[model samples]
Target: MKAIVIGGGVIGSSIAYRMSEAGADVTLVEARRIGGGTSSTSYAWVNACEKLTSRAYFELNWAGVKSHRRLAEEFEGSNWLHRPGVVQWQGAGAEAAGFDEGDFDKLERLKEWGYPAEKIDTQTLAELEPDVDLSTFNPEGAIYYPEDGWLDGPVYAGAMVAAARQRFGLKVVYGQVTELLTRNGAAVGVKLANGETIEADTVINSSGRWANEAVGNADHELPLAPTVGLIAYTVSGDTSLRHGLRTPLVNCRPDGAGRILLRANDIDKTLPFDTEAVPSNPAAQELLDRVTQLMPALKGVHVEAVRTAIRPIPADGYSAIGPHPALSNYYVTVTHSGVTMAAFIGEGVTDEIVHGKSVSEFAEFRLSRFF
Candidate 1:
């Protein structure tokens, strides 16, 4: 089968690689560089912890976590998936009240679901993350999930595309997709901004923030309530932080090298949803300040770069996968947790497209639900 995938972010790259591996002729089209979009700016936390909205969502994310392990085994020696685990604590300013009732309830729920979770006291926390300063916000304990990890999206995406090219002869086109060409109610191909038309038997829309634009004249609409996220990267410095950290003030993790990625939920709300540029200095500096408080070793570190990207969330805030409701040959795979779900969704979607086998787990996340 001939397949054309739009977007070169993590999702699109994964699908393209899997499809090519399945012996399908695949072409990947990217507007800019691979992973230059939302994938690059994402926190890239690979976990099922925050996916507490529903059991199905939770299971999907869990499968995603396992998929990362499989990918690591398959691609042995890749440094993209770092699974040192994550540690989270709860409290107010400069005072740790330990886990709140809500936090405890979530931990209990995770434990009941057979997820690896344990409460570690200050000493254990210190042992796990020796560089972190636990004096001011001395919490009784913190929750640790041994299975959680962080992904370097751009590195992974680039690796996948390179592997696909070397192993399966995947074709990659670098240009903006201007239209999704259709004939007789079936997707036929796509037209690039340079007026080049590449024909295909099937088209998969994995375009993150540009989903609607990729639809072109398909006579279907993808409802996306994308939100802007601001992430600040610190200058490479001396720091031994080994795990993803979630505290009351900031959420951070190692961003390869010696740089750390920092973000805060409260800071995200301060930015406008429609913003396309980097936020002001105050917002970027705030992330550095917050992380410095948590890790005093980063005291003299400066903000290296601040990236703002739109999170592609379906209207209801769940994944939308499967063939388009009205267009049989056009498929879509989009979600807010693209980093975590990319591998699983890529494998499952490939089975559905290449072998005509329906993925049972995708039943609740179909595009037809919204239509």
Candidate 2:
């Protein structure tokens, strides 16, 4: 069977690798180079905090996180793995009603996933993190997730691409899928930018932000939305900032590097991808100033890198990862957390396409959920 995947980011590469791993003829199309989109600009945080608000999202992401852990070990030779604990910071009353410590049900939901969190006292927090000064922190406490952290985003995508093409014998096409070719309301193939048409029995819409466009959805039936995320690296290279000290994965307060990797709550949401946007957000600037108060080491750090990429956000607060409603042969798998959930998302999609297994955790995440 021939399967064509759109997008060469982590999600596309992952699905390509898994499909080829299951003995399918897989071809991936990318408008740009591999890992060159949001995946490239990703300031990844792979903590199990994606579903902190809802119990179900928490469970799904927790499962995805565990899958990532196993894949990290399985793909250890790629050197895309890192074990840095995620530090969730909250100010004043935010902690009480925040992503870190919002609800007791959320904690209970997390407990089922084998993630036991604890509130850290100020003195204990200071002892554990001597570099941070919580003088400005007015939170009741902070939650620590020992299993959460970040990784080399591009390296992971490269590793998946290598495994798919070299090991699994998948075809990696360095082009864009301009349109989805259909026959009798069923997807048959895709037309590339070079006008080359390749027949495909299954066309997976794994494109992160451009899936709908790839499938010719001018009406926008899907609930997908994009938000710009900015990444700023520090030139000082403070070793104190190496522990993956982050706030909430969806959206939290400023981080230790004096550079806030804004979460979903702080999302600069807008439709249609825009890269020419400037780096001037009052909230982000405030984040930088506040982070220095917490970590004095960032007082003199130079900004190393600053880039913006559109993050896909589903309306239901979950990813759309399955076959199309009317066209099952044409599937879609996308999310803002693709960096964190790529491994699992790939595994699940491959299971359905190659092994005929259903992803129970995300049954509602399919496009059929809306229709």
Candidate 3:
């Protein structure tokens, strides 16, 4: 079947890779460069621990973590994927923001569910993260997930696209898909902004923050409440932070060779959604201060860049997959935790598209609910 996959972020890249693996004639399209959207600004933390809502969602992400490990092993030479573990701590500031209870409760629940979790004291925490200044934000204890890790999203996505094209003869079309061509109430192909038209048997909309607009191209509504997040990158400094750290004030992980990525939940709200522009000067300075407070090793480091990106979240704050009732041959795959869930979703979506076999795990995330 001729399949058109929209969006070139990690999720869309994965879908294209899996589709090609399943022997489908796939054409991956991206408006901008691949992984330039939410995937680029993502924290890229590979974890199921953050899924505090649905057990199925948690399971899906947990599976994604495993899939990533296998993928890393398959591409053993790639240095972008790392499973250095992740540390999460709650502090007085988090409690003041009313985030302590839910965060702590999620940790406890994960342990009960047989997930490997460790509650470490100051001494143990120091051993795990030697460069961190415990004196700055000392806590009673912190939860550690030894299975968690992180990846460079854009790098991974670009690699996947390359693999799909090289191994499976997949074609990648670059340009904006301005409209979804339809016939007899079914999606048949896409019309690009440059006036080129390509026919396809199926169209998969994996268009991150622009998913709602992609859906609207077919004149159908896909409810998406896209939110913006600010991610600041600093030139890598001398640091012994070997693991991903998610603190009350900052969530950070290593990026590239000598760089660190920083973000905060509250900081995301200060920026506007869908703005490709860099964060304002004040926002950038505030982020740098927050990062310094969380990791003193980064004190002298300069803010290389701050990206304001719109997160791809469905209206109900859940993954929306499967074909919509109003349109035929058009499938959607969108979620808040796309980084954590991309691998599993990609493989699952491939199965559905190729063999017409729907995976049971995706039952809760289908698009039928929106109808």
What tens digits encode model 3's per-residue C-alpha lDDT throughout 132-216? 7787544668888887888788888998899999999989998998788899989999888898998999999899778767654
Between candidates 2 and 3, the TM-score winner:
3
Off by over 4 Å in 3: 95-104, 216-219, 274-280
Q: List CA RMSD, all candidates.
A: 2.6, 3.6, 2.3
Across residues 11-59, which tens digit of lDDT does each residue of candidate 2 receive?
Answer: 8888888889999999888888888878877767676664565555656
Q: Which is the leading candidate under lDDT?
A: 1
How much lDDT does each candidate structure score?
0.86, 0.68, 0.81
In candidate 2, how many Å is residue 69 off?
0.9
* Candidate 1 weakest lDDT stretch, 10 residues: 93-102
Q: Identify the candidate with maximal TM-score.
A: 1
Residue 93, candidate 2: alpha-carbon lDDT: 32
Model 3: how far residue 231 lies from native, Å: 0.6
Which pairs clash in model 2?
250-263, 250-264, 251-263
